[model samples]
Target: MTDVLRASKFSEWKEDFNWDTCLTGREKYGNFLVSILTSETNGHVINLNGAWGTGKTELLKRLYVSIAKKQHPVIYINAWESDFINDPLSVICAEFLNQLGYLLANSRPKKELVDINEALNKLMGSISKVAYIFKLSSLGYKAVTGDATLNEEFDFSQTLLDLTTQQNSSSMSLENYNKSIISSMLGNQIDLVEGMKEIRIQITSISHILCDIYGCNSPIIILVDELDRCRPDYAIKTLEVIKHFFDVDGCNFLIASDTESLQESIKCIYGQGFDSERYLRRFFNQKIALKKPSLYNYLLKKGIDFDGMCPNMTLTPYSNDNERKIKLLSEMLNNDKFELRDIERFIQKLTACIGYISKFNVKNAKFINFCVLAYGIYEHEKNVNIFKERTNKMSSHGIHCNGYISNGMSVSNFITIHFKMVTLANSSKRYNLDGGWGSCSYQTEMLTVESQDLQTRDWRREDLIECERLIQNYRNAPNSFLLWEDYQKLIGLTDAIE
Candidate 1:
């Protein structure tokens, strides 16, 4: 099998259709993100909510590139990544400095910014040592800032005051800074609280300094992605970091995650009896959800690159038959409520399992797509017997189960499963004889007396037993992820049996 070559999508923005197509119903959603990120507002939290695998990260990536084109300072944190850190404050301070470091370098701010960088390095090291800079790193900071053995060894109250006093030619500014810095520190006798307060102030001061350096007109846009995937403790800590530390003048936070996932995480942290949604609402100023794209538009957007295909390409241009297959796939997606990632995953797995399938023969591709997705949704992928049996019932009952309530609501015994067929021989009354039978809507079907012939077909007990044959055959394949017997059977029970 030959592999299909793919192109780099980094420059895909150059193709105006990506944003203009409205295929995903996100044209305005993307536009709104760009507006908020580039807007003059400061200290605002804007949310982009979408289900897992529904393109939240994709949307943010596009927005990051677009807004940064205007020289806006933006910080992107994959919260899922930093969740491993023991200290939430440490993660917050680290990301803030990491991204700001790039902005400072990229903006080429005046020479005074040099002093700020030095101050920040010292401030960051101190915050890490005080909070959770792992054991080994903590030892280094303990030596640099103060001894690890004593309380008075590290004067948390004097960190900023001493740093500011060094620039005493500007004595008035130093006095005001010292008062604000030490007053809060001395008032809070708790050592941890004092360290946290200092960290928050340091972030705010840097934000203000950046705004001044970048001409004070640009609001820094911080994109926090994948918070929904973090552990509840990690996720909540991330939110607190944003609320307390990044909430300052000249800062706008655009966080991309689903409200439901975050709510669940909150519930996990607090008791199940807690009102998680209400608690989560305190963090964001506005939330915008990306609506699920319609079947036609969704398929259209996913299939656009298939126009010019090669053996080594990830996509294949549809022929008359492939287009028909796509229509059926689209209906399956609609019926099953498959999110963007699910659909893409189904395709990727389908391609790898059965490489280089012609547009004329996607029957097996469509068949495996549904089965694999069904097993995935149900978390039954590890059990082939259960998966196969469940697939049969799923197709027979005109039902679609996504395994869990949060992923999607399962559709059971529909009036008409639009993408499915109605079989004549058995209980699969809502099934068709051909896998591609349901895709044609704009055309007319020929009425014939030959339908009476299907009524007389013979029944066999072996037909049911052959299901075992299928299970074993799939297991024998070099790549078991894609089952290639094809969806010829997907037409319905009798279709496969006959």
Candidate 2:
């Protein structure tokens, strides 16, 4: 078998990977930042929700890199890893402080701030070894005139007085040249150890000093990725933290998550009252849903240039219309001459064949396999639904057995068991087949079909066995509402046997 060429995560693929690759989406993200990163809009949470494997993380990475390249100090963190099912707020705060320290270490501030930093450093060095102290108190007092308040002339003097006289670090204030210099360097800082509201105010104030007011305009963007990978609760809390802490002036935050997965999680955790749909719509200000490009397009963009990998196949423009080609392919797959069962069988065969063909270094073959698998599953589901609608009884799709029948089962029966197994399989590996057929192990049981919606028709005898165990396990338990419902649905099983 010829080896398939792997897609690049960097360099050649970078163009297709970055914000510029999706120009329209980039603009939308920028627009979201402009609307929310304002003085008054400090704690606005925004979610960048999309389906799983839809490149949300890729977008966030590129945006983070772009903002940093443009000279905005940026911090990218994966909340999923950091929070670990704990309160995300504390995690975010820790991350914020970590980034702040990094920024301070890399402070190549503007010329004015540079000068102030040096002067303050010299003055502060004479006083103490503490990390956060400015020693401009005596000099600041001398610089002030009586016409102005004494405190106004001396910045550090006020802080020193507060520390010594009031015996309280909280009483320390910024009032003189020290205040102006410190403010000039780091913006208006009432205090750092305060609550969320104060932190946002500080961020906004520093933003003014760094860009708007100070003329050194650079964008500060924060990218939070892998949110969907987190446990459902962590993911939700991460969203809340973004809303509370980072959505304000001079700072932009972008979050990426799997929308469907997240929605399901939210529904499960918060129940129906949360209005999962509305909540999602509001959170993800700029959601970009990416459908994996068609096989043809994917291959065409991969380029014909072969580096280390062999270019075993190629695509050329066909004289025939594209729609005509697609239609012909569809006809071949959906030929009416074939029996309904044959069509289903053909799909299984085609999926296996296509999967094998995808190993080649050609886009078309790879795409054909992808399309075939996707559409095959889609078509199979449709067929199952149609059958259900017409017959009213959920007939088994394929024939499979729990090996209980001494006489053996037919092919259709075998396939039906397989289909049902796939459809009703739960987290545990165990399942049950109809009748006496069930899993090899009696201890491990599967959730009943009544508990969850089925995705496919092929189920095994293991499915039924698993479901039986699950029903029994939850029997008489205090929190067995869902299981009870499933049990109730299975109470009258006369139809399934027929």
User: lDDT: which candidate is best?
Assistant: 1
Sum up the clashes in candidate 2: 34
lDDT of each: 0.49, 0.41
- lDDT by residue (1-498, candidate 1, tens digit) is 000001112244434434654456666767777786667455788778888778887677666655655556666678887677755555554554444443433333444645565554445443333233222333443454354521232332233234444444343433454444435443555754765555555545555555554443367777889989988888887888788766766678888888897898788778899998888789888888876777566776666333233233222112223453455456545633467776665555444333334343443322233333322332222233433443322233224432222123223311122112211112212212221123334332221111122221231223222322333333354233233123222222221121
Off by over 4 Å in 2: 1-45, 99-103, 114-194, 212-219, 280-296, 304-498
Tens digit of lDDT per residue, candidate 2, span 1-498? 000111111223345545555522444554444334332223334566555544556556565544444445455677766654365654554444344334433333444443444333333321221112223222232243122322242232233232233232322343353344434434444432333565455555545544532233344556688877788777877776677666666666667666767787888898956778778676555554433333233222333221112223211111123342232223333322333334334434433433333344222321121222223333333353532332112333422122222123332333332233223333333322232233433343343343334432344344344434434434433142222222222222212321
Model 1 residue 260 CA deviation (Å) reads: 1.5
- Counting clashing residue pairs in each candidate, in order, gives 12, 34
Instruction: Give candidate 2's error at residue 378 in angstroms.
Output: 10
What is the alpha-carbon lDDT for the whole of candidate 1? 0.49
Off by over 4 Å in 1: 1-25, 110-205, 304-325, 349-396, 399-498
Worst 10 residues of 1 by lDDT: 1-10
